[model samples]
Target: MTVFDDLVGQAQATAVLSRAAAAGAEAVAGGRGAGMTHAWLFTGPPGSGREEAARAFAAALLCPDGGCGHCDQCHQVMIGSHPDLEAVRPQGLSYSVKQTRELILRAAGAPTQGRWRVILFEDADRATESAANALLKAIEEPPPRTVWLLCSPSPDDLMITIRSRCRVVTLATPSTEAVAHVLATRDSVPHDMARFAARASQGHISRARRLALDEGVRRRREAVLAIPPSLTGVGECVSAAERLVKTAEEEAGVATAALNETETSELRKIYGEGSSGKGLNRGLVRGGAGALKELEDRQKSRATRIKRDSLDEALLELVAYYRDVLAMQFGASVELANDDHRFELDRLAQSSTPEETLRRIDTIMRCRERLEANVNPQIAVEAMMLGLRRP
Candidate 1:
């Protein structure tokens, strides 16, 4: 086993990172090195595993035996528990300046145990302008033993000045075969189910795993897929829109509920309610209430973002269904993402013309744009469902 095992289908990137890790080890050993840099930018489309690659590189850099995957160092890095590695994943709409400044302040310190102190930021493109500026200072004058790993959807998503300071790693979307192989091998999913999930997810590794392992996820996806073909009239379109929004809300709640409770409990302990603190100090209680309020606000915003993302996933699933229909209509030999639903795809293809399929695809895309722009989700989705009706 190797550190790059989990980074499926990214051979070029794995090789680049492996060489860089070796150079980092040599650098610490007082030898000449190659392909070692203080900062790295990993760019890829969603589900391409940019953050996964960064974590593997961190493990390799920290492991004494050059990233022996079974070592404690590698395990710690993989689970994000290593003392020398800090991973920042923004929970809300953006990474605020305050949080970035705090991270920068912590990053100025030297490594505690590992050869290098690694700061990994997933979705670095979500950093606010002021936060990005704060991060820029750290990259410009990083500590000798500090490394920064930034992940984004594309190089262009980041400020040019910041991108210029970092070595770039690009990852391609993995093929359906690669995704299915990983699902079957790593998650122990049945071969046929793994193949179905892989095709449905369109190379999204996490979604593929979830779709393979979770019946509810598959059911939700089936519902989304059914909506396109069921939009026979105004009432059905409106009902489908409501169902989609409600399902998204439920999904978002499920995602955040446990996390919210854990955070609240931690805060309570910090504020003197639990054994971690002395019997409630009045002044501390007042401060704690303010902190709790701020946390709740962040949680609300996070919940909203989660709902939007869930809705978008369903929208994309509908889009893929039509894409497959169009592919069938044109006799395209390319792999279909919804191959598990070939019967439905055939029915849709036979029922609708290519122009209708293309128009419906456009409607779904527009709904996505509308959601991103903060338009009412129900309104946009209702219109999209109506537009998807057979003409």
Candidate 2:
């Protein structure tokens, strides 16, 4: 097997990266930077395996065999334990300039054991403006043996200076058939459920896996889909909005609760929480308050980001449902993404004009934009539900 094998439906990108990796092996051995770009930018839509692609590419470059997929070198890269590979994933909403400078300092060092140094940075788009500028400097003049792999949704998400300094590898959303095949073959999901989740996921591979296997995810989706039919009056619309926002919050809380507690506990222990010995760094113990406050701020930002992401997923599901209703109204021959809701789709299609469905879609899109602009979640969702209420 090769490092690129698990990258489903990205034949073109796999081929490009494979050739680059082959060239990279030669460059590393010959002590020449020929036939390899020092920096690469992986751009794709959500669930397009941007981070996975970066990780695989790092393995290929680090492995002596250009990614045999089973060697110790490849395994280390996968687990983020390779001495020469620096894999960074930003947990907070933004990566600060201070963090960027530190990362660049680490990247500037020579390789320890591996032939070349590699940095795989996920969510490169989350770098703050000042941080991006700092990153640009490092990418512009990276060490001869250093390689940078940055993943983002699009080239536009990064600065032009940084974009121009990197070779671009764009990945496309995998087809439903391809996603379903992977779900069945890799995740061992049953055929019928795999197809259903694949269709509903709208090309998001991770989401398809969750929908196919996670009962909580499935129930939450059902609740979101149940919103449209229940908006009979203003009060119902208000309640629907409340329910939608609350669901996002609940999911975020579940995701962050244990993580937040673990981090807090670790910080306390480090700061002499249960100390009894000559921890004569009482000054350091007193300094824990400031560090704790910083950690709290970061956790809050992370929670907010997760909550917004959860709400965005719900909004996208609503968009898909209305899109199916619009398709039914037009008598389109194409298959519906929400085919399981055929009864409701048909009823809504007959009761509403295509124009009305389009209006509702526009309203949902507006709500998504408002949320991105940092409008209060309750207010934005309420406005959307009110607009979605049928006349």
Candidate 3:
């Protein structure tokens, strides 16, 4: 399949980009029109293929055949080896001014391979104010043969000045059917498993893929989904809270340990263990310390975010369960998100009122807000569990 095929449920975005690329090519060939713009902003939710779309467009722009999937140009862009294409992905919490200046300097130069130079800012929302200002200046009056692509959750996530200067391409979340099709066709997963992952992920492609591939993920989800009916007392509420905290910690530990090891190895290589013999190499020591500090800081931030995201996923799962409960309460026969949990949900429907289920949904939403507001994830989850357990 083509790169465009990977962008599920984004037909409008694909059409807009295809047309733009075609028009740009035509302009170049006919020697007319206000040549291609130097900047583009791709806005979409996480796992919505915003960066993938940008890369595809970049490939098309560089390829003579308009992104023939098998061509050298397309292959190079896909693997990130294209000389004219540079992608800036933040390693730490945010892109620094130094990194933005480096990109700006590169953008000021002529293309090394293709007719135009391309710079992609993946997750531009992570850029610091100084970095954003530096990038803004570059976008304000880019070099003649330069093109910038910025990816973010939405146009509002970027500075108004920066947003006003670029063309915007928006992508919506894919449907469950689209996600299921992708899982079955691309990953060769079983149809039933693919459907369950698609429905449970709530339109997140990467999460759906993970849920399909990892048995542990599926098991964890099952455990979370089972919590609603079992939370019958204060002790059960505390136990649920403890379990969620432990799960988040385990996931965060796995993520951070891998990153920490990589960073530590890189730092050791840079320092070179007394090779200089210059009495401790204070500069190298300081640099290594700073890098470790930055790595740890970013890891802390990421851990917090991961916990909240994990909790949010659990909340969504709970919502789906309750929604089914509500439907059953109202004597509706609609399809359920957690059809596998039908027995448990049916029990809930019989035990609780529809109004109580709605209130539980509201509590889940407030828990999400609290997590977003930087409240302790464990505390927010604990309170949510307590509220869910109340009669």
Candidate 4:
């Protein structure tokens, strides 16, 4: 199948990209746009497949057969192995100046394929000011036959100067039905299960897919959604807060440990044995120390991001729980994401008024804001739990 097949529920976006590719092809044929300046900005919500769209566009631009799915160029662009397509995804919280400089240098060179040279800056919002400025210069006056694609959540998330230099392509979140249909058709999942996952994910495709495929992800979601009904007292509220923190810690540990092992192995390869703790090799020792410090810094950033991401997911599940309670209170026949816990939701609906559920949702939203403001995740979640426990 075509690379565009991976993008779910973005028909409008697909159309826009397809038109651009067709225009680029026409330009090449007329010799007026023989060497097209390939620069684009793809903006959309999380899990909206912004990067997937970019990859498809890149494949279409490079494929002489007009993105014929079986072509070598299309396959390489889709898998990120194309000789002329460079994708820069930040490893940590933000792209560094060093990385930006490297990318700029790479962009300055001519393409080996004698076609368009494409550079995709994924999550461009994560670039530091210096990195952004460095990239801005390249975009302002890119080399011939060079194209730059920047992906972010929104245009406002990027510097206006950089945003102005590229063409903007916006993607909307797909409807639940659309997402469910894609999962059923593409992933071969059962229809009911796909619909449940799609509704629970709130239009996030990757999360919906994970919820459909992974038992652990579904279990974690069920646990999070079950918390509101269990909060009968201070003890229970505290217990819920503790459980959330432990889960965040466990998930963060998994991410950091794997990252740490890779960094340690790379460092060891760079510095031979007997390089630690002595006057044996001063340069190697200093280099090793610096590398380890950099790794630790990145690991800390990753841990923070993982914790925030986990809490965000938990918040979404909590919102769904309250929504189900609201639906029950209104005597609505709409399906619930947590249908398996209908008994608990019924109890919640009976004990808490509709206003109470709305307020609880507000509290969760505030906690999300607090976490985004760099507050400690544990404190934010605890405060939310206590608020949710209120009468």
Candidate 5:
């Protein structure tokens, strides 16, 4: 197996990356080839494996045998433990200029052991304008031995200057068959469930795996699917909105609770609170308050982001349900993403006009935009539900 093995259905990308890895190996051996570049930009839609491709490329660059998948360098890159590799994943709304500058400074150093120093920045599109500017200088005149790997949804999401400075590696959405096969082989998921989840995910590999493995995810999606057929009027719409918001909050809470606690504990330890002494020294504790407060602020921002992500997932599910309805209404022979909800889709299609179904889809998309724009989730989703109600 090679480093590119896990990048499902990306044959072109895999071939390019393998060639590059061979070049890198040759460069290490005092020869030259086409694979080595100062920077690489990986662009793909969500769950299309952009970040995975970046990580694999980094591993390949660090591996002497050109990314032997079972080697120590490859394993370390997979788990993000390699000394020559720095993987950045933005946790909150946007990466800060300070963080960008720090990483740039660190990128100036030579590789400790490997032939190249690799910085893998995931969600590079989430960088604030200032952060992006800070990153620009590093890519423009990168250190001779350092490589930058930036992952974004699309090159258009980044500034033109930055995109122009990097070699582009585009990943396509995997086929349902590819995703289902991975779920069954890698995760040991049952064939039927894997196929269903793969279809429902619409080519999102991670979501397909989650849907196959997590009963909670399946239940949550079912709840969202139940909404369309139950929208009686304004009252029911409001109730449904409340239910969606509550469910999103609960899911986000479950995701962040342990992370928040671990961070808090680490802070307390650093401030001497958890030691064997007389608790935290009052003076040290007082001085550390500002740091703790900043951390909490970041955590709060993260929690908000988590809630928005959860709500967006639900909205996507709702969108699929309506799309299935539209397909049935038009007598389209295309397969349904939510075939398990065929009864509801058929009922809704028969009861509503195609125009009405399209309008509801528009409303759901608008709600998603509003949430991204920081509108109150309840208000945006409630308005959407009310729009979805039959006259």
Candidate 6:
């Protein structure tokens, strides 16, 4: 139950952070912080636990007993309530330069409750270029007690100047068997279901948990998998494309609805919009209009990000299914990601050549690239599905 225990398949990273934590403790005792870097860049593929590892590192650095899991210090860090820690996770599409400047100013302060002031920044890759430049200054001239833990999918995702100044911590993807074991033990999922989720997710821990626990998620995924076999005609392929886009939009709305409401409610309270016991200043509401407008704009941007993520996931699932088909056509011995759909997979594999399967996968990848380049989701998916049409 140590802080690092939750990070599966990251022994190398855990050891590095552990020694650094010891060094952090030594530094706090009026000695040099040997083996400790002022900044760390945590890089991993999606669901490889970049944020989790960084948080554990922060906990170890701040905890007096070296990350004793049950201590108050560790518990506070888990819930992001530690006085000396600042957790920054951007909900919008990008972290703006204005926000970066404000954050840098705040991070310049000394530690409040621990030996180090820890800034755990998730999705550091989403910062705009201007925002990254602003961040580079702080990292270049960091405060003595400040520690920056930045998370991204890859080292190349950030500016060279920013990444070179930080120690890199790379996490490997958890194996399917390892992910299944965690789901069965920690989430209490049945063994068979856990294995299926792990295999389907291709080692994405959070996605495996959701697939195991949520029927709605499984249904949505099944629909995406069904697309390849059902693309019999041009009209049907177009229809499937529309359905996928609609599904992504609905999923994003469902995911963000509660969060959106909560944020709006909190902002209203800050502006004194509700609970009027009479004689409240009418100017209060008027003055808060701009703030409310800004909140609305940010929420829209967040929804766009969520929708894009949903669509991208659907696209990846499609790719996995075709990959299985290609593997079967070539008689590869690897396990199929969509083994449960063996009947459909078999039929598709027998009907198509390996080259055709490859072309479809390439098309899906191109669609993903189009989406990343800000092309319309509907157009990109439609083009992909049309390319995948059997006849």
Candidate lDDT scores, in order, read 0.90, 0.91, 0.83, 0.83, 0.90, 0.91
Off by over 4 Å in 3: 27-30, 33-36, 91-103, 274-286, 326-335, 353-355
Question: What TM-score does candidate 6 get on C-alpha atoms?
Answer: 0.95
Looking at model 1, the pairs that clash are none
TM-score of each: 0.94, 0.95, 0.86, 0.89, 0.95, 0.95
Q: Give candidate 2's error at residue 8 in angstroms.
A: 0.8
Error (Å) of candidate 4 at residue 18 is: 0.8
**151-232, model 6: which lDDT tens digit per residue?**
9999999999999999999999999899999999999999999999999998889999999999999999989988887888
How well is each residue in 21-107 modelled by candidate 4, as lDDT tens digits?
Answer: 777777656666532346789999887888888888888888886677788999898889999999888766678888899989988
Error of 4 at 277 (Å): 9.4
TM-score of 5: 0.95
Candidate 1 per-residue lDDT over residues 74-140, each given as its tens digit = 9999998999999999888788999999999888888999499999999899899999999999999
| Superposed Cα deviation of residue 366, candidate 5 (Å) | 1.3
lDDT for each residue of candidate 2 in 1-391, tens digit (9 for 90 to 100):
9989989789999999998998888777775546589999999999899999999999998898989999999999989999999989888778999989999999999999757899999999999999999999999889878999999999999999999999999999999999999999999999999999999997789999999999889999999999899999999999999988998898889999999999998987897767744452563557877888899999998898899999999999999999999998888997688999899989999999999999999999999999978899999999999999953
Q: lDDT score, residue 99, model 5?
A: 90
